[model samples]
Target: MRNNEMHEAGQGVLEDGHGRRFYYLRLSVTDACNFRCDYCLPEGYRARAGEAAPLSVAEAATAMRAFARLGTRKVRLSGGEPSLRADLPDIIAAARNTPGIRRVAVTSNGYKLPKVIDEWRRSGLDQLNISIDSLDAAEFARITGHDCLPRIRTGIDRALELGVQTKVNAVLLSDGATERLQQFLDWLRDTPVTLRFIELMQTGDNRDYFASNHLRGDTIERQLIESGWQLLPRAIDAGPAREYAHPDYRGSIGLITPYSRDFCQSCNRLRVSAQGKLHLCLFADAGLDLREEIRRGDVAALAERIQTLVGGKAASHYLQQGQTGATRNLSVIGG
Candidate 1:
């Protein structure tokens, strides 16, 4: 399963049996999150078995170091809320400075950014994706079950004002969030941040939640067009989202349609859960346990194991085939 072709090109970039070279690593640092987004966390999620302990900041860096050396270029930090980790800046710095990792980014709820922005800036963090599903206070509170949208909104504004290359991530819950989505579109018209709407995905625990809240990317675009917005000439090449822009607006909009738009053909990423389980597909439970190998200092074996697992990445996830269950939820797997 070793990718001799990638090695022949230079450094050991991971390539699967399907021939996909993964340059981006979605590294989840913790399975804990501050908010209880209805679609992300199940109603009784925490009542189940406790999560495996997460990697320490240093341990996370070590994992990053290994992946970097194995030719992973970009690493994004995620968590229940990555900002909740105390050593986040250090973790970001470590990933940034890792020899082969070219950039480090973070996915957060943004409520904690006010406290970590300075350290994050100094650490050379490249991108920040704030999970903001709504700009309306009541709607936001209803979705996340937290009355912290004020803080999160302030956090997004601060990140943008501070010159952080920030992006806004919102989930499309078709039934009850149309007004909220429109409000966000109107509000973003004057802001400098790019907004990306992710189509709600279904998982085992949140199946009902997903059903009640799901929205399609195409529906959103139709609304935008009806409201006098134009689709951009081309979508941004990064990630799954098809991009769009407004003629009068400075920023753009992105659509992450994992269900309807199945981006499997262009998939080029891997994920490591906080407790050291390597996930090949976000919606697949199959994973490689790297906790012991990584903790015991066996870099060569760990890399080899990763190569073998990558070789088995399925043609596409079960979710793409209408199956919506996974061993891990989006929060645990780092979204």
Candidate 2:
């Protein structure tokens, strides 16, 4: 069969009968992080054994091309901080130039974004999602365990000034962070950036932090309503985040309730770690390695392996109360 014919046949269902429509590929370009955020890294976190090496730019692009050939589009490059990757613009350009890729984006902590926002825009980056939990400078520093709020603020403004679509991702912890949420919303009311509130996921080495600072999405929505913020309906894509618009605000709000209400049923994304593991679910313990196969010039075999992996995807991750398993970190999985 022709390449398009093979790709179409691989669509709708995997080889083992799992539907494969709407493939979202998240590629982690690196594992090195600058900030030691309490929610993500805590005070004295150490990398797990054999979790150091990151994929090279060439390998990342090759894997993206292979996946693109298999009907996988909508790629997002993430990392401990994707902006830290030196050749990130090159990687973005490669994915954007790849056939079958409809969307290309990046999620960064926004420290070094100001310097490269124009370069990234020129490289075909469609959207930029920066993690900014608190508007208070001190609170933001405490949350991230770093003094880079000014850089982050500048990066956000620069992205907006360059006419790049931007989204600010804030994780709502139970440390009386609602006020900070309101502060961020108030500041963003005049800007074009969309504010997204993420309910902290209970995975990775930061489980203890999540346990101590867990906040639900319902409480957040109630607080926003009580603050006279009317949530207007807005159309969003098939992502985990539920988006809302406010009448008195120019920007929008997005709630990602992965804990309160998991959207795994409609999950169309697959995460590839920097070390080359294909994770079917975010909370999965193990994954298939496609790096070696792809390097060996076995594109058809790699495609078949991806199909098998997708077919084996669970209806929902088994994240029950008091369950213990070895799950990859969100930073490594590019969430």
**Tens digits of per-residue lDDT for model 1 on 213-328?**
66778888777778677665532125667777778777788888787645787787889988898988887765678988788766567777788778888877757556754644
Whole-model lDDT, candidate 2? 0.75
Task: Show model 2 residue runs off by greater than 4 Å.
Answer: 1-20, 44-52, 224-238
Local accuracy by lDDT, each model: 0.76, 0.75
Score candidate 2 by TM-score against the native: 0.88
Question: Candidate 2's residue-wise lDDT over 1-335, tens digit each?
Answer: 56764553324333223443546678888766787777776653457785647777777777776677666757888887888788999999988877767778899988888898989999999888999888888988887887888888898888888788889888888887758776877786798778889887777576777789988887887777786766555322235676776777888787888655456655767788888888777787776788787566665677767776777776666665633234645666666
Candidate maximizing TM-score: 1
Q: Model 1, which residues run further than 4 Å from truth? A: 1-10, 42-51, 225-237
The clash count of every prediction, one per candidate, is 3, 0
* TM-score to native of every candidate shown: 0.89, 0.88
lDDT of 2 at 264: 60
